[model samples]
Target: MLAGLSADYYTRLEQGRERNPSAQVLDALSRALELDADQEMHLYRLARLVPASRGGGGREPVSPMLLQLMDTYAATSAFVLNRTLDILAMNRLAEALFSSFADTDNLVRMVFTDPAGPEFFTEWHRAAQSTVASLRLAVGHDPHDARLTRLVEEISAASPAFRQLWEQGHVRGKTAEAKELLHPDVGRLSLTFQAFDVRDKPGQQLVIYQAQPGSPSDHALKLLESLSANYRDHEDADLP
Candidate 1:
Protein backbone atom coordinates (compact mmCIF):
# COMPACT_ATOMS: atom_id res chain seq x y z
CA MET A 1 0.00 0.00 0.00
CA LEU A 2 2.86 2.36 0.71
CA ALA A 3 4.16 1.74 -2.78
CA GLY A 4 1.15 3.66 -4.04
CA LEU A 5 2.74 7.01 -3.06
CA SER A 6 3.38 9.20 -6.13
CA ALA A 7 6.97 10.32 -6.67
CA ASP A 8 5.88 13.97 -6.71
CA TYR A 9 4.00 13.58 -3.44
CA TYR A 10 6.91 11.87 -1.73
CA THR A 11 9.34 14.42 -3.08
CA ARG A 12 7.18 17.31 -1.93
CA LEU A 13 6.89 15.90 1.56
CA GLU A 14 10.64 15.34 1.72
CA GLN A 15 11.33 18.83 0.39
CA GLY A 16 9.07 20.30 3.09
CA ARG A 17 6.51 21.65 0.67
CA GLU A 18 3.99 19.61 2.69
CA ARG A 19 4.67 20.37 6.34
CA ASN A 20 2.12 18.12 7.99
CA PRO A 21 0.91 14.68 7.06
CA SER A 22 -2.37 13.15 8.23
CA ALA A 23 -2.33 10.29 10.74
CA GLN A 24 -3.21 7.76 8.02
CA VAL A 25 -0.46 9.14 5.79
CA LEU A 26 2.06 8.84 8.59
CA ASP A 27 0.91 5.31 9.36
CA ALA A 28 1.25 4.30 5.70
CA LEU A 29 4.72 5.79 5.52
CA SER A 30 5.62 3.91 8.69
CA ARG A 31 4.50 0.66 7.06
CA ALA A 32 6.27 1.50 3.82
CA LEU A 33 9.51 2.02 5.69
CA GLU A 34 8.89 -0.93 7.98
CA LEU A 35 9.13 1.43 10.94
CA ASP A 36 8.97 -0.22 14.33
CA ALA A 37 7.49 1.42 17.43
CA ASP A 38 10.61 3.46 18.12
CA GLN A 39 11.11 4.48 14.50
CA GLU A 40 7.47 5.47 14.08
CA MET A 41 7.75 7.77 17.09
CA HIS A 42 11.00 9.16 15.72
CA LEU A 43 9.26 9.78 12.40
CA TYR A 44 6.68 11.87 14.20
CA ARG A 45 9.44 13.79 15.97
CA LEU A 46 11.20 14.56 12.69
CA ALA A 47 7.93 15.80 11.28
CA ARG A 48 7.66 18.30 14.19
CA LEU A 49 4.06 17.30 14.87
CA VAL A 50 4.27 16.01 18.46
CA PRO A 51 2.03 18.07 20.74
CA ALA A 52 3.91 21.14 21.95
CA SER A 53 2.39 20.79 25.38
CA ARG A 54 4.31 17.55 25.74
CA GLY A 55 7.51 18.79 24.09
CA GLY A 56 9.53 20.88 26.50
CA GLY A 57 12.87 22.64 26.26
CA GLY A 58 15.92 20.94 24.77
CA ARG A 59 18.15 21.16 27.88
CA GLU A 60 17.23 20.91 31.55
CA PRO A 61 18.99 22.85 34.23
CA VAL A 62 20.44 20.82 37.06
CA SER A 63 19.05 22.10 40.33
CA PRO A 64 21.32 22.49 43.33
CA MET A 65 18.84 20.64 45.50
CA LEU A 66 19.00 17.71 43.10
CA LEU A 67 22.76 17.56 43.34
CA GLN A 68 22.47 17.67 47.13
CA LEU A 69 20.00 14.84 46.97
CA MET A 70 22.42 12.75 44.97
CA ASP A 71 25.11 13.39 47.60
CA THR A 72 22.91 11.78 50.23
CA TYR A 73 23.24 8.51 48.32
CA ALA A 74 27.01 8.57 48.56
CA ALA A 75 27.32 4.85 49.20
CA THR A 76 24.70 3.86 46.63
CA SER A 77 24.83 4.19 42.88
CA ALA A 78 22.89 7.29 41.88
CA PHE A 79 22.97 9.58 38.88
CA VAL A 80 21.10 12.32 37.05
CA LEU A 81 20.24 12.32 33.37
CA ASN A 82 18.90 15.13 31.26
CA ARG A 83 16.19 14.67 28.64
CA THR A 84 18.63 13.25 26.08
CA LEU A 85 20.11 10.97 28.73
CA ASP A 86 23.25 12.96 29.31
CA ILE A 87 24.88 12.25 32.65
CA LEU A 88 24.73 15.58 34.38
CA ALA A 89 26.01 14.29 37.70
CA MET A 90 26.54 11.08 39.67
CA ASN A 91 27.34 9.94 43.18
CA ARG A 92 30.64 8.27 44.02
CA LEU A 93 29.23 4.76 43.81
CA ALA A 94 27.86 5.45 40.38
CA GLU A 95 31.22 6.81 39.31
CA ALA A 96 32.89 3.62 40.55
CA LEU A 97 30.68 1.51 38.28
CA PHE A 98 32.14 3.22 35.21
CA SER A 99 35.67 3.87 36.43
CA SER A 100 37.10 1.53 33.80
CA PHE A 101 35.41 3.16 30.81
CA ALA A 102 36.84 6.25 29.12
CA ASP A 103 33.44 7.70 28.30
CA THR A 104 32.26 7.18 31.87
CA ASP A 105 29.90 10.11 31.75
CA ASN A 106 27.56 9.39 28.89
CA LEU A 107 25.29 6.35 29.34
CA VAL A 108 24.37 5.93 25.68
CA ARG A 109 27.95 6.16 24.46
CA MET A 110 29.14 3.72 27.10
CA VAL A 111 26.46 1.27 26.05
CA PHE A 112 26.81 1.58 22.28
CA THR A 113 30.48 2.36 21.65
CA ASP A 114 32.46 0.77 24.48
CA PRO A 115 34.55 -2.26 23.57
CA ALA A 116 33.26 -4.13 26.61
CA GLY A 117 29.63 -3.10 26.11
CA PRO A 118 28.33 -6.55 25.25
CA GLU A 119 30.23 -8.41 27.93
CA PHE A 120 29.92 -5.86 30.66
CA PHE A 121 26.19 -5.41 30.26
CA THR A 122 25.53 -9.17 30.17
CA GLU A 123 21.98 -8.49 29.08
CA TRP A 124 23.02 -6.34 26.16
CA HIS A 125 20.11 -7.13 23.86
CA ARG A 126 17.37 -6.22 26.30
CA ALA A 127 19.35 -3.30 27.70
CA ALA A 128 19.89 -1.91 24.23
CA GLN A 129 16.22 -2.26 23.39
CA SER A 130 15.16 -0.48 26.55
CA THR A 131 17.75 2.25 26.07
CA VAL A 132 16.68 2.94 22.51
CA ALA A 133 13.11 3.17 23.68
CA SER A 134 14.02 5.62 26.44
CA LEU A 135 15.91 7.68 23.90
CA ARG A 136 12.87 7.78 21.67
CA LEU A 137 10.78 9.03 24.56
CA ALA A 138 13.38 11.67 25.36
CA VAL A 139 13.65 12.95 21.81
CA GLY A 140 9.93 12.91 21.22
CA HIS A 141 9.73 15.92 23.53
CA ASP A 142 12.71 17.73 22.04
CA PRO A 143 14.06 16.54 18.71
CA HIS A 144 16.05 19.57 17.65
CA ASP A 145 18.66 19.18 20.42
CA ALA A 146 22.01 18.99 18.61
CA ARG A 147 23.67 16.92 21.33
CA LEU A 148 20.91 14.31 21.21
CA THR A 149 20.91 14.35 17.41
CA ARG A 150 24.68 13.83 17.21
CA LEU A 151 24.69 11.11 19.83
CA VAL A 152 21.99 9.18 17.94
CA GLU A 153 23.79 9.57 14.62
CA GLU A 154 27.07 8.40 16.11
CA ILE A 155 25.50 5.41 17.80
CA SER A 156 23.65 4.50 14.63
CA ALA A 157 26.86 4.53 12.62
CA ALA A 158 29.05 2.88 15.25
CA SER A 159 26.87 0.02 16.45
CA PRO A 160 24.50 -2.05 14.40
CA ALA A 161 22.91 -3.27 17.64
CA PHE A 162 21.80 0.24 18.56
CA ARG A 163 20.64 0.96 15.04
CA GLN A 164 18.47 -2.14 14.97
CA LEU A 165 16.79 -1.28 18.25
CA TRP A 166 16.26 2.33 17.21
CA GLU A 167 14.42 1.21 14.10
CA GLN A 168 11.85 -0.68 16.16
CA GLY A 169 10.08 2.59 17.05
CA HIS A 170 9.59 1.36 20.59
CA VAL A 171 9.16 3.85 23.45
CA ARG A 172 9.27 3.08 27.17
CA GLY A 173 10.12 5.07 30.25
CA LYS A 174 12.13 3.65 33.11
CA THR A 175 10.30 1.13 35.24
CA ALA A 176 11.20 -0.67 38.43
CA GLU A 177 13.34 -3.59 37.31
CA ALA A 178 16.24 -5.72 38.35
CA LYS A 179 19.49 -5.19 36.44
CA GLU A 180 22.43 -7.53 36.18
CA LEU A 181 25.94 -6.42 35.41
CA LEU A 182 29.33 -8.11 35.12
CA HIS A 183 31.80 -5.89 36.86
CA PRO A 184 35.38 -6.11 35.72
CA ASP A 185 36.50 -6.43 39.33
CA VAL A 186 33.64 -7.92 41.34
CA GLY A 187 32.18 -10.25 38.67
CA ARG A 188 28.38 -10.48 38.51
CA LEU A 189 26.10 -8.05 40.32
CA SER A 190 22.33 -7.74 40.62
CA LEU A 191 20.64 -4.51 41.54
CA THR A 192 17.21 -2.89 41.45
CA PHE A 193 16.86 0.50 39.79
CA GLN A 194 14.35 3.30 40.30
CA ALA A 195 13.92 6.29 38.01
CA PHE A 196 12.31 9.48 39.32
CA ASP A 197 11.34 12.45 37.24
CA VAL A 198 12.45 15.88 38.45
CA ARG A 199 9.17 17.76 38.25
CA ASP A 200 10.90 21.15 38.32
CA LYS A 201 13.03 20.27 35.32
CA PRO A 202 10.95 18.78 32.53
CA GLY A 203 13.51 16.31 31.19
CA GLN A 204 15.65 15.59 34.20
CA GLN A 205 15.50 12.25 36.00
CA LEU A 206 17.18 10.82 39.06
CA VAL A 207 18.12 7.15 38.99
CA ILE A 208 19.34 5.02 41.84
CA TYR A 209 20.51 1.41 41.88
CA GLN A 210 20.58 -0.68 45.01
CA ALA A 211 21.08 -4.32 45.91
CA GLN A 212 18.76 -6.22 48.21
CA PRO A 213 19.91 -6.78 51.77
CA GLY A 214 22.26 -9.73 52.42
CA SER A 215 22.51 -10.50 48.70
CA PRO A 216 25.80 -11.13 46.93
CA SER A 217 25.21 -7.88 45.09
CA ASP A 218 24.87 -6.02 48.37
CA HIS A 219 28.17 -7.43 49.59
CA ALA A 220 29.80 -6.49 46.33
CA LEU A 221 28.52 -2.94 46.59
CA LYS A 222 30.03 -2.68 50.06
CA LEU A 223 33.35 -3.78 48.69
CA LEU A 224 33.06 -1.37 45.80
CA GLU A 225 32.28 1.47 48.19
CA SER A 226 35.35 0.77 50.26
CA LEU A 227 37.55 0.64 47.21
CA SER A 228 36.21 3.95 45.93
CA ALA A 229 35.94 5.77 49.24
CA ASN A 230 38.33 8.47 48.22
CA TYR A 231 37.23 8.69 44.63
CA ARG A 232 35.60 11.93 43.54
CA ASP A 233 33.73 12.77 40.41
CA HIS A 234 35.98 15.01 38.35
CA GLU A 235 34.59 18.35 37.30
CA ASP A 236 34.88 18.77 33.58
CA ALA A 237 32.91 21.69 32.21
CA ASP A 238 33.89 20.81 28.68
CA LEU A 239 32.60 17.26 29.09
CA PRO A 240 29.61 16.44 26.90
Candidate 2:
Protein backbone atom coordinates (compact mmCIF):
# COMPACT_ATOMS: atom_id res chain seq x y z
CA MET A 1 0.00 0.00 0.00
CA LEU A 2 2.80 2.45 0.88
CA ALA A 3 5.14 1.58 -2.02
CA GLY A 4 8.75 2.36 -0.97
CA LEU A 5 7.82 4.76 1.83
CA SER A 6 8.38 3.90 5.48
CA ALA A 7 5.42 2.79 7.59
CA ASP A 8 5.55 6.08 9.48
CA TYR A 9 5.31 8.07 6.23
CA TYR A 10 2.35 5.99 5.08
CA THR A 11 0.62 6.74 8.40
CA ARG A 12 1.12 10.47 7.82
CA LEU A 13 -0.36 10.19 4.32
CA GLU A 14 -3.35 8.34 5.69
CA GLN A 15 -3.72 11.02 8.38
CA GLY A 16 -3.82 13.67 5.58
CA ARG A 17 -1.20 15.95 7.24
CA GLU A 18 1.82 15.19 5.06
CA ARG A 19 1.83 16.59 1.52
CA ASN A 20 5.12 15.72 -0.16
CA PRO A 21 3.92 12.80 -2.31
CA SER A 22 4.81 12.87 -6.00
CA ALA A 23 2.37 12.26 -8.86
CA GLN A 24 4.40 9.18 -9.75
CA VAL A 25 3.76 7.75 -6.29
CA LEU A 26 0.05 8.53 -6.49
CA ASP A 27 -0.22 6.87 -9.87
CA ALA A 28 1.70 3.86 -8.63
CA LEU A 29 -0.68 3.38 -5.73
CA SER A 30 -3.70 3.86 -7.92
CA ARG A 31 -2.48 1.23 -10.35
CA ALA A 32 -1.36 -1.11 -7.60
CA LEU A 33 -4.84 -1.03 -6.12
CA GLU A 34 -6.33 -1.55 -9.59
CA LEU A 35 -8.56 1.41 -8.81
CA ASP A 36 -11.32 2.41 -11.17
CA ALA A 37 -11.52 5.99 -12.44
CA ASP A 38 -13.48 7.20 -9.44
CA GLN A 39 -11.22 5.52 -6.84
CA GLU A 40 -8.13 6.82 -8.60
CA MET A 41 -9.50 10.36 -8.37
CA HIS A 42 -10.28 9.92 -4.70
CA LEU A 43 -6.68 8.91 -4.00
CA TYR A 44 -5.51 12.07 -5.72
CA ARG A 45 -7.87 14.17 -3.63
CA LEU A 46 -6.53 12.60 -0.43
CA ALA A 47 -2.94 13.15 -1.53
CA ARG A 48 -3.68 16.75 -2.49
CA LEU A 49 -4.19 17.68 1.16
CA VAL A 50 -0.61 16.98 2.23
CA PRO A 51 2.04 19.75 2.37
CA ALA A 52 3.87 19.92 -0.99
CA SER A 53 0.90 17.84 -2.20
CA ARG A 54 -0.84 18.65 -5.47
CA GLY A 55 -3.86 20.86 -4.83
CA GLY A 56 -7.46 21.27 -6.04
CA GLY A 57 -8.43 18.31 -8.20
CA GLY A 58 -11.88 17.68 -6.80
CA ARG A 59 -14.93 17.03 -8.98
CA GLU A 60 -16.47 20.03 -10.71
CA PRO A 61 -20.01 21.15 -9.93
CA VAL A 62 -22.94 20.02 -12.09
CA SER A 63 -23.19 22.20 -15.19
CA PRO A 64 -25.56 25.18 -15.27
CA MET A 65 -27.30 23.79 -18.34
CA LEU A 66 -28.06 20.59 -16.51
CA LEU A 67 -29.58 22.52 -13.63
CA GLN A 68 -31.73 24.52 -16.02
CA LEU A 69 -32.83 21.37 -17.81
CA MET A 70 -33.98 19.78 -14.58
CA ASP A 71 -35.73 22.93 -13.42
CA THR A 72 -37.46 23.28 -16.75
CA TYR A 73 -39.38 20.09 -16.10
CA ALA A 74 -41.24 22.03 -13.42
CA ALA A 75 -44.61 20.31 -13.69
CA THR A 76 -43.03 16.94 -12.98
CA SER A 77 -41.25 15.88 -9.80
CA ALA A 78 -37.64 15.87 -10.98
CA PHE A 79 -34.40 15.89 -8.99
CA VAL A 80 -30.69 15.70 -9.70
CA LEU A 81 -28.88 13.34 -7.38
CA ASN A 82 -25.30 12.13 -7.18
CA ARG A 83 -24.25 8.48 -7.04
CA THR A 84 -24.58 8.69 -3.27
CA LEU A 85 -28.09 10.08 -3.77
CA ASP A 86 -27.33 13.52 -2.39
CA ILE A 87 -30.08 15.67 -3.88
CA LEU A 88 -28.25 18.49 -5.65
CA ALA A 89 -31.41 20.27 -6.82
CA MET A 90 -35.12 19.91 -7.52
CA ASN A 91 -37.99 21.70 -9.17
CA ARG A 92 -41.12 23.02 -7.46
CA LEU A 93 -43.16 19.92 -8.24
CA ALA A 94 -40.48 17.76 -6.66
CA GLU A 95 -40.48 20.00 -3.62
CA ALA A 96 -44.23 19.66 -3.31
CA LEU A 97 -44.20 15.93 -3.99
CA PHE A 98 -41.46 15.21 -1.48
CA SER A 99 -42.80 17.53 1.16
CA SER A 100 -41.67 15.29 4.00
CA PHE A 101 -38.11 15.18 2.69
CA ALA A 102 -37.96 18.98 2.32
CA ASP A 103 -36.06 19.36 5.57
CA THR A 104 -33.09 17.21 4.53
CA ASP A 105 -31.18 17.48 1.29
CA ASN A 106 -29.68 14.01 1.57
CA LEU A 107 -32.06 11.32 0.29
CA VAL A 108 -30.44 8.47 2.24
CA ARG A 109 -30.54 10.40 5.49
CA MET A 110 -34.15 11.32 4.94
CA VAL A 111 -35.09 7.72 4.24
CA PHE A 112 -33.33 6.16 7.19
CA THR A 113 -33.61 8.97 9.74
CA ASP A 114 -37.26 9.79 9.33
CA PRO A 115 -39.85 7.70 11.14
CA ALA A 116 -42.36 8.56 8.45
CA GLY A 117 -40.31 6.96 5.67
CA PRO A 118 -41.43 3.44 6.44
CA GLU A 119 -45.06 4.48 6.55
CA PHE A 120 -44.81 6.47 3.35
CA PHE A 121 -43.23 3.64 1.39
CA THR A 122 -45.65 0.89 0.43
CA GLU A 123 -42.74 -1.51 -0.02
CA TRP A 124 -40.66 -0.16 2.80
CA HIS A 125 -38.33 -3.10 3.24
CA ARG A 126 -37.58 -3.46 -0.48
CA ALA A 127 -37.13 0.28 -1.00
CA ALA A 128 -34.81 0.58 1.98
CA GLN A 129 -32.77 -2.39 0.88
CA SER A 130 -32.57 -1.13 -2.68
CA THR A 131 -31.27 2.22 -1.50
CA VAL A 132 -28.55 0.61 0.59
CA ALA A 133 -27.55 -1.57 -2.32
CA SER A 134 -27.34 1.48 -4.55
CA LEU A 135 -24.93 3.11 -2.15
CA ARG A 136 -22.80 -0.01 -2.10
CA LEU A 137 -22.71 0.01 -5.88
CA ALA A 138 -21.64 3.65 -5.79
CA VAL A 139 -18.76 2.81 -3.47
CA GLY A 140 -17.65 0.14 -5.87
CA HIS A 141 -17.90 2.62 -8.74
CA ASP A 142 -15.83 5.27 -6.91
CA PRO A 143 -14.05 3.78 -3.95
CA HIS A 144 -11.83 6.86 -3.71
CA ASP A 145 -14.58 9.37 -2.84
CA ALA A 146 -13.71 10.38 0.71
CA ARG A 147 -17.09 12.03 1.15
CA LEU A 148 -18.88 8.86 0.14
CA THR A 149 -16.64 6.79 2.39
CA ARG A 150 -17.44 9.12 5.28
CA LEU A 151 -21.15 8.94 4.49
CA VAL A 152 -21.05 5.15 4.55
CA GLU A 153 -19.23 5.18 7.83
CA GLU A 154 -21.69 7.66 9.33
CA ILE A 155 -24.73 5.70 8.20
CA SER A 156 -23.21 2.43 9.34
CA ALA A 157 -22.74 3.91 12.78
CA ALA A 158 -26.21 5.39 12.84
CA SER A 159 -28.17 2.34 11.72
CA PRO A 160 -27.25 -1.31 12.03
CA ALA A 161 -30.03 -2.07 9.59
CA PHE A 162 -28.30 0.02 6.97
CA ARG A 163 -25.01 -1.67 7.70
CA GLN A 164 -26.50 -5.12 7.15
CA LEU A 165 -28.00 -4.05 3.85
CA TRP A 166 -24.80 -2.37 2.69
CA GLU A 167 -22.54 -5.33 3.33
CA GLN A 168 -24.61 -7.40 0.92
CA GLY A 169 -22.86 -5.74 -2.06
CA HIS A 170 -25.91 -5.43 -4.26
CA VAL A 171 -25.78 -3.31 -7.44
CA ARG A 172 -28.63 -2.30 -9.69
CA GLY A 173 -29.65 0.90 -11.42
CA LYS A 174 -32.93 2.43 -10.33
CA THR A 175 -35.50 1.81 -13.09
CA ALA A 176 -39.13 2.47 -13.89
CA GLU A 177 -41.18 1.29 -10.93
CA ALA A 178 -44.50 2.02 -9.36
CA LYS A 179 -44.69 3.21 -5.77
CA GLU A 180 -47.51 3.91 -3.39
CA LEU A 181 -46.79 6.82 -1.06
CA LEU A 182 -48.94 7.00 2.07
CA HIS A 183 -49.28 10.68 2.64
CA PRO A 184 -50.88 11.70 5.91
CA ASP A 185 -53.06 14.28 4.20
CA VAL A 186 -53.43 12.73 0.76
CA GLY A 187 -53.71 9.07 1.69
CA ARG A 188 -52.14 6.59 -0.75
CA LEU A 189 -51.00 7.94 -4.08
CA SER A 190 -49.58 5.54 -6.64
CA LEU A 191 -46.85 6.97 -8.84
CA THR A 192 -44.44 5.71 -11.48
CA PHE A 193 -40.74 6.52 -11.24
CA GLN A 194 -38.55 7.24 -14.26
CA ALA A 195 -34.80 7.80 -14.23
CA PHE A 196 -32.73 9.66 -16.80
CA ASP A 197 -29.03 10.24 -17.19
CA VAL A 198 -27.69 13.76 -16.72
CA ARG A 199 -25.51 13.98 -19.81
CA ASP A 200 -23.05 16.61 -18.61
CA LYS A 201 -22.74 15.27 -15.08
CA PRO A 202 -21.32 11.80 -15.13
CA GLY A 203 -22.31 9.67 -12.13
CA GLN A 204 -25.38 11.83 -11.55
CA GLN A 205 -28.96 10.96 -12.54
CA LEU A 206 -32.32 12.69 -12.83
CA VAL A 207 -35.39 10.95 -11.40
CA ILE A 208 -39.03 11.83 -11.75
CA TYR A 209 -42.26 10.46 -10.27
CA GLN A 210 -45.48 11.00 -12.14
CA ALA A 211 -48.96 9.97 -11.08
CA GLN A 212 -51.06 8.21 -13.67
CA PRO A 213 -54.01 10.11 -15.13
CA GLY A 214 -57.60 9.54 -14.01
CA SER A 215 -56.60 7.49 -10.99
CA PRO A 216 -57.17 7.84 -7.26
CA SER A 217 -53.60 9.08 -7.16
CA ASP A 218 -54.72 12.13 -9.15
CA HIS A 219 -57.16 13.04 -6.41
CA ALA A 220 -54.53 12.46 -3.76
CA LEU A 221 -52.18 14.75 -5.68
CA LYS A 222 -54.75 17.53 -5.43
CA LEU A 223 -55.06 17.03 -1.70
CA LEU A 224 -51.29 17.07 -1.39
CA GLU A 225 -51.26 20.49 -3.05
CA SER A 226 -53.80 21.77 -0.56
CA LEU A 227 -51.83 20.39 2.37
CA SER A 228 -48.65 21.95 1.04
CA ALA A 229 -50.31 25.35 0.74
CA ASN A 230 -51.63 25.09 4.29
CA TYR A 231 -48.17 24.24 5.58
CA ARG A 232 -46.56 27.08 3.67
CA ASP A 233 -49.14 29.52 4.98
CA HIS A 234 -48.46 28.46 8.54
CA GLU A 235 -44.73 28.75 8.00
CA ASP A 236 -45.14 32.25 6.58
CA ALA A 237 -47.28 33.29 9.52
CA ASP A 238 -44.61 32.13 11.95
CA LEU A 239 -41.91 34.20 10.24
CA PRO A 240 -40.99 37.50 11.89
Off by over 4 Å in 1: 1-59, 230-240
Clashing pairs in 2: 18-50, 19-50, 19-51
RMSD of 2: 8.6
Best by lDDT: 1
TM-score of candidate 2 to 2 decimals: 0.67
For model 1, residues 1-240, the per-residue Cα lDDT tens digits are 464678888899988898788777787898888876656866787676666534353455578988888878855799888767788888888888777677766778888888777777889877787778888776666657687889889999998888888887678777567788988877788988999878877767889999998999999988888777644323344357
Q: 123-217, model 2: which lDDT tens digit per residue?
A: 88888886775666564444577878888888888888888888875555666788878776667888988987666566677888888777888
**How high is the CA lDDT of each candidate model?**
0.78, 0.70
What is the Å distance of residue 173 in model 1 from its true position? Answer: 1.0
